[model samples]
Target chain A: MSDSTPSTPRGSADPFVPAELYTQVQQFYARQMGLLDDGFPDAWADTFTEDAVFQEASRLDEPLRGRDAIRDSSRARKKRLEAEEIDFRHWLGMLDVRPQADGSLHARSYALAMRTRRGGELDIFASVVCHDRLVSVEGAWQVAERDLHHDGSGRD
Target chain B: MSDSTPSTPRGSADPFVPAELYTQVQQFYARQMGLLDDGFPDAWADTFTEDAVFQEASRLDEPLRGRDAIRDSSRARKKRLEAEEIDFRHWLGMLDVRPQADGSLHARSYALAMRTRRGGELDIFASVVCHDRLVSVEGAWQVAERDLHHDGSGRD
Candidate 1:
């Protein structure tokens, strides 16, 4: 559902924003998330801005800062999941995208992390609200900041 | 992942489509699926054309034809889920939308159905690929036909 209101002042006067931009953002997340889930931390990290900040308030004492930090953490997580023989799939939906005045886009989406065991058992690992600040870099959208509010974490 | 190739001509000459139309289609699915998941079968069914056809080849001997039939099946499924005290959320991603020559849209997406029990236990209920033909009715998009191919069903 749309989280933005008239007070938010979208880039367009029309009720809806451009479909191409929205599609690009969606495809960006799909590729980025797919990379991370597929154990390609370097590729996934490349989708973020050099100075990206990722915050998971309930899990980490401090937000992960910069591409290096994000990549490191992602690599560690991939290794751990591999050792555990588990697979993860991140599904994002209910996106609410708003274009900012400075050319960046403020997007929020419902993120669901599903885990599947080697034995074919699957479960929802986490349900979270993802807030992202996305900017265009070389004609592609990259995440500058991502804040995750996990369900029932009481941090949202 | 875009399912369509260069052989599939989109409405525009540009590689990407109008963001407004893509956003509208996404919003339409969000609302339609949300209504069904929230137990509003009537509203969910209304999102389909009066003569809509839904095919779940693996599950049924024949396709569900017409809005009335779709509503009845949805209501029945809602009752069964209620009895089982389970919540099902349908998530769609990796959308590839192509504007057809008839002004309709041929859209394909990965669909995931997650089930959550009363005690907060959750699992991936099903993974499927969904193909849809959408038409605009009264300035809003409605499902004219939907074909679902379950993962590993050997039907795709």
Candidate 2:
């Protein structure tokens, strides 16, 4: 650990947020992605809080609320992919994590979800920006709310 | 700064990399994105090293080598976008930054590029996975090499 504070050329007011926390959040998301891609939807759902909210851009009118709803939707999606024999990979990048005054975190990142049909070529199925509000639960950061903002959506 | 090192659930060997360093790298990339989006092609080009290698998945046949080449390419791109009157925005997310043995950094993230044609609706132009090799030059992180992997490129 270096004692030096991070240099913020853009003059960020909150320059004192611990870097380790950011790393932890990055790792948390990585684990979530891994679980989702590796066919472990149940495990992935466990990463969220009991009262977490997950919203998809296309279905903003009906956001999934609570862990059960999130898990059910994930399982249904996974089942559909399996039934269709589609191989999907979700890749995430450009994570911007900020500390909130409430001791939680406001995190955002870009996501690319690609799918490949059996013996068919791969195609980008979705490109969206994920905005998340994460809270620490039992010394671990759990996503409390996630909102997906679809890029190129004129509404956004 | 907390003396306690972050607990690594996945057994990351380099858990001790300073959070400040990670924050600096994130900020560096954010600044680069801001410059490009704000139409500062020259300043954006300055984010790369003199001997940097920039490769795009769609243009692997002609990788841009050196700062001059990078700047020229960026300027040309800006000109083309302007000539066509296309409004473009690139968003990056889910950054995974790791330390290299040589004190550089190996980073990966997802990128979403959107473009809106004149009198047309916005659409996703490109979705890519960015693999970057970054180095700290003069206490600031610079892109030493960037290899973009387009997700869902059947070739991948």
Q: Which candidate is the best by lDDT?
A: 1
In model 2, which regions exceed 4 Å deviation?
A1-23, A34-156, B1-18
lDDT of 1: 0.79
**What is the per-residue lDDT of model 1 for residues B49-90, given as tens digits with 9 covering 90 to 100?**
999999999998999999999999987887787777666778
> Residue A128, candidate 2: how far off, in angstroms?
10
Clashing pairs in 1: A18-B19, A18-B20, A19-B18, A19-B19, A19-B20, A20-B18, A20-B19
Q: Return the lDDT, model 1, position A49.
A: 97
Superposed by TM-score, candidate 2 places the C-alpha of residue A123 at a distance from the truth, in angstroms, of 8.4
Evaluate all candidate structures by whole-model CA lDDT and list the values in order.
0.79, 0.75
For every model shown, what is its TM-score relative to the native structure? 0.58, 0.60
**How displaced is residue B156 in candidate 2, in Å?**
3.8
lDDT of 2 by residue, A1-156 (tens): 144645653435656446577677776776577566546666778788999989886766898899998788877877787677665767776777888789888888898777766555557777899999999887767899999988677565
Write one digit per residue (lDDT tens) for candidate 1, span A1-156.
112212112232233456777677778888889999999999999989999999998679999999999999999999999999999999888776777789998887778988898998877777666889999999888999999966444313
CAPRI-wise, candidate 2 is incorrect
lDDT of 2 by residue, B13-45 (tens): 234346676567668778898888777899998
